[model samples]
Target: MKKILISGMAAFILSLAVPCAVYAEEYMDGRTENGTALSVQAMAVTEDIHRVVDVLKTGRMDEGSAGDASFWQLGAGTFSMSRNIMEAAQAQAPAGARLSSYTQDDLYILAHVICGEAQSYPDDEQLYVGSVVLNRVSHPSFPDSVSAVVFQRGQYACTWDGNYYREPTPQNWANARYLLEHGSVLPGNVVWQSGGRQGSGVYIRTRYHCYCY
Candidate 1:
C-alpha cells in the first residue's frame, strides 16, 4: 500500500462520486500463502458484494482496517461515503483479523523492539517480550504508549544495542501481530523481570525468558 498525494481539485471531484460503484475492482485475488492460485473455475462473486453493501449501508466500522483513517484524511470532513467504502473494502478482505487499537507506527515500533530483544527466542518467548512492552503501556506504572515505553531510559538493552533500528523478519512480524491481537498468555499481574534472577514472588518463566511482578 503505497501512499499517493491527491490535489484539492481532484479530491473534490472524487468526493462527489459514489465510492462503492466507483471502486468495485477485484482485489487481493492473488495466490494464497500456500501458493495456490484462485480457482480458475468461475465463482459467483455475489456474496462478497452483498457483504460490502451491507457494511456500507449500515455505516458501521469494525475494530481495525489497515490504516483506513489515513486513506480518508486527504478529504477530511468531505468524504463520509468514501470512508464507508474503504471500511467496507477492509471488512471484506480475506484476512479480516481484528487488531488491537494500536496504530501502524505502534505496531512497527513494537515489532522492532521485540525483534531486537528476543530474536533468538522461540515464538512464544518472542511474544512474551512483546507482551512485556504492551503490558507496560497498559499498566499504571509505565508509559502509556508503545514508543514512550520503549524509549524510556534504562529499560531495554536493545534500545542502545543498535538492534532497534534493524529490519524485523517476517516471522517477527507474525509474532508481533499475534501478541497485539490476542494479548499475553501470561497473567496480567506478572509485569516485570530480567533474564537472570528470580525476584521475591512466584515468576512466569519460560525457556530463556523470565517475567515477574
Candidate 2:
C-alpha cells in the first residue's frame, strides 16, 4: 500500500488534487488504471444499491448488513487501531479476503458512523473518516465485519456518547454514500481515528478530527 503522512487539512486537499479519474472505479475492483492488480480484500455485494440511496434520503441506520477492522488510523481525534491488530488482519487474508457478505445494511451502518463522527466537517474530511472505516473492514488485524468495528467498545465517541443514535442529515448520508460507492484515492490502509486532540502519526486533521496511520 502507498505510505504517506496525512499531516493536516492542507495535505487532505493535496491528496484530492489527483484527477477524479484516479477514483473512477465502482466498488473496490482491486486494479488501478494502469491495470496493475493489487492484493485487496474481497468487497463483492449483491444488494440493490437503491436501498442504500433510500436510507440516505431518509436518514435511517436500521435498514441494513452489520458489525465491524484492520490497519490503524485516528478519526476526528478519538479512535485508534494498533499495529499489532493490523498485522493480524493481513494474516487472515493471505491472498486477501472477499467482502461478498457486505450488504446495503452494512453500507448504512457505515454511513451512520460517519455522520455521528464527522457530519460537521467538510465533505472531503468526512470522506477520509469513512475511508478509514472501510480500510479496517478489509484489513485482517481487526474484526472482519462492519458492525463489529463500529460497535466495538471505546472506539467511537458517537457509539458511547449517544451521538450514534442521532439521526443523520441528508448531507451526512450523502457523504457516507459517496465514500461507500466511490472508494477514496487516499490510503485505504488507515484504521485508526481520533477526535478533540491530535495524536502521533496523524495523516490529516480537520477542525474537529484527526486521521492517522
Q: Largest lDDT belongs to which candidate?
A: 1
- Which lDDT tens digits does candidate 1 get at residues 101-182? 8688888998998889877668878877887787777777888888998999998888998998888988888888787777
What is the per-residue lDDT of model 2 for residues 32-75, given as tens digits with 9 covering 90 to 100? 42221211211111111223333335544432234101111112
lDDT of 2: 0.51
Assess every candidate by TM-score. 0.50, 0.50
Error of 1 at 117 (Å): 0.7
TM-score of model 1 (CA atoms) = 0.50
The regions of model 1 sitting more than 4 angstroms off are 1-100, 198-202
Any idea what lDDT model 1 has? 0.58
Instruction: Provide C-alpha RMSD values for all models, in order.
Output: 19.0, 21.1
Residue 21 displacement in candidate 2 (angstroms): 26
- Find the 10 residues in a row with the least total lDDT in model 1: 35-44
